[model samples]
Target chain A: MAQPDMTRIEAAGGRPEAIRLETLRFAWPGRTSFRLEVPEFRVGRGEKVFLLGESGTGKSTLLSLICGINAPDRGSVMVDGTALADLSAPARDRFRAERIGVIFQMFNLLPYASPLENILLPLSFAPDRRRRVTDPRAEALRLTGALGLQDDLVTGARAAELSIGQQQRVAAARALIGAPALIVADEPTSALDTARQGAFLDLLMTQAEAQGATLLMVSHDARLSGRFDRVLDLSEIAMTTRGAG
Target chain B: MLLPALAWQSLLSRRITVGLTIFAISLSVALFLGVEKVRTGAKASFADTISDTDLIVGARSGGVQLLLYSVFRVGNATNNLTWESYQDIAARPEVEWIVPISLGDSHRGFRVMGTSAEFFDRYKYRGGRGLEMAEGARFDDLFDAVVGADVAAELGYRTDQQIVVAHGLASFTEHDDKPFRVSGVLARTGTPVDRTVFVSLEAIEAIHVDWKNGARIPGQQVGADAVRQMELTPGAVTAAMIGTTSRLQIFGLQRWINDYPEEPLLAILPGVTLQELWDLIGVAETALVGVSAMVVATALLGMAAMIFSGLAERRREMAILRAVGARPWTILALLSLEALLMAALGVLLGMALLYGGLFAFRGWIDDSFGIYLRITAPSLRELWVMGLVLVAALVVSLAPAWRAYRMSLSDGMTVRV
Candidate 1:
């Protein structure tokens, strides 16, 4: 594992925090009974944090807000010192593509695309991210090799043909491409066994650290929290009472 | 550009569904084009049947009826025009040439036309193209006959072959006693003339001399040789094709023939009567076009239904795309482009099928229906139809595209499915 380079973080921004939220409020439209409120949340720059929550605890909603997929009702979502509310919908999508990389729990790759194609999908959406890599295909090949994906599997096999563990590694490579400032993983290892989960987390964290990026992974399993720098419970962060699951 | 590539790959992933949908659309397209081709081909061939003739003179009756029986040989004439009337019209200074035609006889399901020997020189078809013999010379002997291309080919009749003409339009009453020798076979004309057998007017009068009232007398029979020495000038004829010396004299000559005091004779401009006949059949053509258009609509709607139903299972795919920084509009464009590609392929395949079918069936259609389907490049109207189908496909695709857009927006990186 490569060590984090402090010079890159200082060049990106002098600020100590990677993500900050203040007085956030959100609710689903036409569903008046459920609401989520958070007073404050922060993740430091180059930090590896674990967010623990069961299903139906607004774990996905918080990730959506941080990625700018959904706008908060009242407060601001600021990632890498840029306020998400200040941007238009398309700009927010571009901002997410350039600054944030996300890995879903399962089915993180397009089934029909080859593994190399899935790894380079983000560059297709973000010109800024594409400009960061001088040779996109070579960069994708390097990332796939670092993630233990064989050249034949990356080139010849479709994403659907790979095992679940291989798919998660490809998804991790996709998330870490172009050295995005933030990495958000939503139970990325939930389908893996305990041994593979720890091994996958080690690779993901090492890749994030090498890029000087912050990792925020949300999972229901508490046993995986020991490896992270910090852990936060969703029930403690969200100040509102649970209305409906 | 990347989105269209993605769309293509996505469509290729589900080959069976996409292939079935394209097959349905292509079949409908082929049917639509086929109907349009037949409609235009029928009209063109009908208009090309006869040309350069000023007027068709027959007994006083409907103009369409006169044109049908005299030119198409489709039905019997209600009455006959006297030979005196024909001679009177032919003597007028405006008449350049006149060919007398006598119908009401058959030879093996082919109409037998009794005409003057000069008919070969005066009659014209397909834009003033003169008749040319394929085998031998024109009829000269009293019992000599000539056959059209189709008649000769279909019945295997060669020059000098003897054939018995039957009285009336069917084979029930045969004039077997007076068999005529085939003198010539005309070249193919791609008209109703190709289906007729021709003989000199004297032969027709000789065959009917002993017959009375559509039947033969009990003991009266005329030998083929004995009748050759008698006076064979026909007293009456079914109709005549007349050409004028000047184009300006056609209407005047037609009016004079219609108002002649000798008999109730009708004269009609060939072009005008042909238009009237076509207009009468235009209603059926319009109905056929309408039915084919509906079939196209149905096929397009089926494609819409197929894509719309597949969107449900694709919710997770949409979420994955959204998570990778694809906007809702990107998903919308991707689905719409997939449908457009399918429609374009279907159209191309349909054109190939249409031309292939036409090339395979051209001869059969000409022989069976007398409609010469020219295998030419697609007309502007046909290209416009394909363009309209693509537009329709784009419009129909919006339904599924809009649905996927909404799904990607709402699902937003975390679809439950």
Candidate 2:
């Protein structure tokens, strides 16, 4: 009964799902820690969802477990119908590189690398990062233009040299560079000033929408919930808490 | 993921740590190679000292000390043999020829030896070869002298220059009356003889004629005319070089010399005595090498400590690499590469330090102890040791690499802290 998203839509007369979680038992090993028993969760292809939860609500850990970082003690996580639990560590890393994009909350970008170099990292690791774009510079430029990163910053500016807001944009550009099927941003704008957070999140969601990327953004802010096509709160839907949400 | 520039940047960013590690490694390499270079050179020079001579005979002493004083001029003689005893031994049928030596004096720290003219004809060195003079000839005349190549070259001793005999083993010659003329300069033998001056027995006697108990007896001095009438021969000499006529008769020669009732004497084969000397001095070599190895090992520990200590601080950096799809092993590989690269740099710098140090202080070493250090680029031994040290360093430094691997693996989406 993987029916977490009850209002599933039909794309061209057939149902489509990008992410699925079933009976996922995620927990910290020691400290008699509580575990997250995910009964069910699903995201449709091309969907944008802002997953909101307070601090320590097990949202980040859910994202991690779904991304194949931590294996569920029971049940499974499925990315495009493939069980993440079935994949080996190296294979899991490869799958994430090719199909998934993650933007961390703070210092998400490699500090020493230029903006473009940081963006190009997915291709450096993921074998499938290359699509029709032959020249990485050209692809990077096109993506940077779409994201509205500064024109000068497009040419190899170190990520640490940028402002906090700029680092978020650079990470978004990197997440979108490979046109991955799914992009997850875990409180990506928490460190940015209030004035810049909206702009960065809007840019990230709009770009993922343009690339046909299913976007799942986790945030503690309740106000951002309505901006997404679907909104979910960990306290309302989360069956268990294993780690920081 | 392991681009050269990236590795270079990582190393550059942590320069203080890298530099300190490199410095520690280089110091160990320098000390290790320095000791090896000096020790090997010393052995080569000492072994190369007496090449052709068979035996060294002295007044009943250990073979090594006998060779030490007679050939290397390293110590004073315990006793001297009377001329009558020397002649008795030389007259033996087993003896081929004898090089009777008179010692115990120097001119400015260089040893002076009074020997018969047969020395020039019989003495051999460095592979049974005779001495090759860079400039003059042998000291055949009783009042003539021959200077060694280094002595002549260093002190600028010219042919036909006059020199007087010193009273003790070094400096302040006793006699100014009879100044011996330099007739020849011996070639570089790389032996202690390179610092010695060769003079005849007649010159030794002539210089001491007016002196009693190593002084010009107050008002009792004998004139040069009357000194010629007095016995010009020395009563005794330090030692003699024995060349047996038959190899089978070597034991006979040793027994005969040892059994001589008139004088207590010791017979030593120069070749065998040299082996004994090497055995006696081997302990120092082992101790020196042991200390140097410990120094090198400690430096490697420093490298591991420095890199592993930085692991916690670098967790974020490592996670960034992971997010970009860098495998955990790649992170480990980079760390190991850094360790190995730093060690290699240190080794090269250490070699340079050793060569420079040798070049700066060679003269002092040679002049102080008469040990001429051969300074050259790294030898096969040094290269092999360097390769082994680097390999060991890499293995020991893997602790940091292992830490890096674990960090990257555990840092899934974000840093733990």
Candidate 3:
């Protein structure tokens, strides 16, 4: 239902400045009490900024809103200096597909699919990114290699066969493979052992640095806070955008 | 990813659910295909009535009824055509051929017919060719007989086997003295002849010489040989097959026979009579469609419950999807695709099972019920129904899919931990 004249993804392409978010307040209209009011959040150009909050403080909600999943009820969330709330649902999806890569704690990989297939699943929906890549499979392998996954693990290893740490690394490679400007990770280290968690974090940060994409890693683990350039606990930033809890 | 691929994996992972669903859908497909098969069978039997000859002449009855009793051996004719009338009718200038058939007799639970060599050479049921001799040739001497394909198979009769005829149509022998040699066996034609035993008309007259009112006379005996030598004079024939000079004269021929003054007669075109008979068969078709539709609908209902029941567990999965930049719409598509895929697999599985069952039991069904369900590849109608099942499954999935979308978006990145 769209004319070719309206395609915007071609103009922005991939760059560190592509995705941006400002003071944003999101409300769930029907469920009277459930609402997320994030007043300020932004991941600067190629900045691997870690955001922290406890389990129930809407840390995941804040990341999703910043990533343009749920449009803010008030204020604004901009990616590449364009207000995300203003775009249509399909446009938002296309935008996310092209310029924003999201990673979840569980990795969100389809169980029966091999790691390579899981890595390529996101590209299926993002036609623009698919076209942009000279060869997406090669790009996926490169990302997987940079994330310290062995070449053998990329082939026949299914998501269920991989350990939690390995799955997290797969999730990271999938996110960074498309060369999207921003990658959002949600409690990705929580499922791993303390030893694997540090190694996993190191691999993820290294991959983000290599891709030169902004990273907004959400976690409640305060011990890991010192590694990032700036660790902003979500609550401290929310006061200005949403006056109270 | 293509929907089927995802669906296939989902189904493979959930073996029990998918198996149950497939079982449910296959039964529905069988019911649907079964109705179509029986309808085709009835039409085949009806068409066998007048395929070769141009016309059928018999005592006045519904054109279809006359065709059924005379050609297909379905029903009995209330009025009999006198032998004199048959002689005059067969003598008509336009009548190129005639095979007078005298019914009203039975042999070991099969219909008994009495006729001459012309009955074997000229009388055609499905096409112009006469019945072939699967074993021995047609009867040459009187009292020599050829049994139908089914009768021979059922009775285990081979060439040179001798069988006795019982008076009337009873299953047991009443006056079984007259024995006839089985000279030939006919091919299976899926018609009444499959259950008939053929003998010369003289044999029929000879066998009954001692019988009166379907019983033996007080003190009379007529040997099979002596009975055949007597002057042949057939009193009545149940029906007669007539061949016209041209197809264009069919209407005129029908009118002429129906208006005959000596004996009331009815003539019917085989194709048209078959179409009318379908009205009677249509009832079963309607019932089958209804039952199969309910089955499919109920299976979809089961699919819906399977999904909605797992909604609580899937909340986390949907949240994960949302985290991976899957829009609410994507979540809906994913869940709905799950249901659509299951229903589709069920339908396909159902069809395959139906084909298998038919392939396995076709012989038994044909033997027992006189019907054959072909395991032939599904036709366009079956495909259309399968397609409908997919669409229905998709629509059926919409409810839980919408709910999943809302649940995911509301919970967002933070599901209730």
The top-ranked prediction according to DockQ is 1
TM-scores of chain A across candidates: 0.92, 0.88, 0.86
What DockQ score does model 3 reach against the true complex? 0.38
lDDT of 1 by residue, A6-102 (tens): 5544654676468888899988666446678989998988999999999878889899989988898999778877778878898888888888899
> Which stretches of candidate 3 lie above 4 Å from their native place?
A1-23, A32-43, A124-135, A239-245, B1-31, B72-75, B127-129, B156-162, B171-178, B210-229, B299-317, B335-378
Cα lDDT for residue A90, candidate 1: 84
Model 3: CAPRI class = acceptable
Candidate 2 lDDT by residue in tens digits, B1-417: 435556666777778889988998999999999999878877766676776556678898777788888988889888888889988888989888889888887887788899887887677765576777777777866668899877898888988888776777754546666667899888776677779999887778777776777667677666545666667778888888878888889987888888888878888888788878998998999999999999999999998998888888888878777776677877887788888888998999898888898999887776555456787767888899999888988898788899889767665665676
DockQ of each: 0.64, 0.43, 0.38
> Candidate 1 residues B30-114, lDDT tens each?
9999999999998888887888889999999999999999999998899999989989999999999999999999999999999
Clashing pairs in 2: A36-A240, A57-A245, A58-A245, A59-A245, B60-B265, B60-B266, B166-B173
Of the candidates numbered 1 and 2, which has the greater lDDT value? 1
Question: Over the stretch A52-95, how does candidate 2's per-residue lDDT look in tens digits?
Answer: 88867778778878777667778878875567776778777777
Candidate 3 chain B TM? 0.87
| Model 1 clashing residue pairs (backbone) | none
Models sorted by DockQ, best on top = 1, 2, 3
Model 3: lDDT of residue B131: 69
Please count the clashing residue pairs in each candidate, in the order shown: 0, 7, 6
List, residue by residue over A35-145, the lDDT tens digit for candidate 3: 676655556678878888887677766767766667777787776556676778777766776777878888467676778877877777677667767887888888888
Interface Cα RMSD per model, in Å? Answer: 0.8, 1.8, 2.3
